[model samples]
Target: DAGVTQSPTHLIKTRGQQVTLRCSPKSGHDTVSWYQQALGQGPQFIFQYYEEEERQRGNFPDRFSGHQFPNYSSELNVNALLLGDSALYLCASSFGTAVQYFGPGTRLTVT
Candidate 1:
């Protein structure tokens, strides 16, 4: 019955560094999606994981990756980070195409 939760409410890293953010989905959920939101901009879908497989992806490059566990938890990993990568990383959980519950989001700052 828990809601979506994301770890490391905030993070700071220099360009070229790598970062990993974690997320735990709400109970009875089987899908997890990741997104990036820049200041003054709407979120851009990164990808979605279900049944431990990536089902869909956005226009982002290969540097953005994610994984979903059997228990429905997920992790997002970004490599070769760029300053432009700084933004809010949000995780959303839902069952099928039903309405999703989003996490508070992890603010990532790239220097």
Candidate 2:
């Protein structure tokens, strides 16, 4: 039972640059969602993917985009990143409406 995994446990990026984060959903799960968590803040849903298409999205801008592969893995790409983009990018997965299991996350530090 492999849980969700993310790369580069930590990262540093400059303002205005772009960054891509990857994720592998937990075994037995078919949906993936991305979230951003800032210091002392709760996770904010960016978007969710099901059937290899975006099923739902939050208040983020177009700069925040994602993709889900047939294998159930996903990736989040942020363009024109800003200093505020510095946060923990979490990947969550679920089988249905059930609770989602989260990964350790890739910390993006925008300077």
Candidate 3:
């Protein structure tokens, strides 16, 4: 019955570094979605995964990628990170197309 969870509540990295964020889906949930939220801005869809396949993607470059495991857990990977990438990364889980519940989010800061 646990809700979605994300790791490394806060992170700081220099430009060009690579980062990996993790998430665990809520109980009985099989879909995971990722989002990026900048300061004073709403979250922007990054992508979504269902049945371990990337079902849809947002307007991000290839540098942004993700994977959902058999257990429904997921990870977000960003390569050659830029200062502009600094933002709060959120993980949301849902059952099929049902309502999604989000995690606390991981705050990433690129310097």
Local accuracy of candidate 3 as per-residue lDDT tens digits, 2-84 = 78899989999999999999999999999999999999999999999999999999999999999999999999999999999
Alpha carbon lDDT of residue 4, candidate 3?
A: 88
Quote the lDDT for 107 in model 2: 93
What TM-score, over all chains together, does every model reach? 0.97, 0.97, 0.98
10 residues in a row with least lDDT, candidate 3: 1-10
Residue by residue across 24-93, what tens digits does model 2's lDDT show?
A: 9899999999999999999999999999999999999999999999999998999999999999999999
lDDT of candidate 2 at residue 25, scale 0 to 100? 89
Model 1 error, position 15 (Å): 0.7
Q: Candidate 2: where is the Cα deviation over 4 Å?
A: none
How many steric overlaps are in each model, in order? Answer: 0, 0, 0
Answer with 2 or 3, whichever has the higher TM-score.
3
User: Candidate 1: lDDT of 106?
Assistant: 100
TM-score of 2: 0.97
Off by over 4 Å in 1: none
lDDT of 1: 0.95
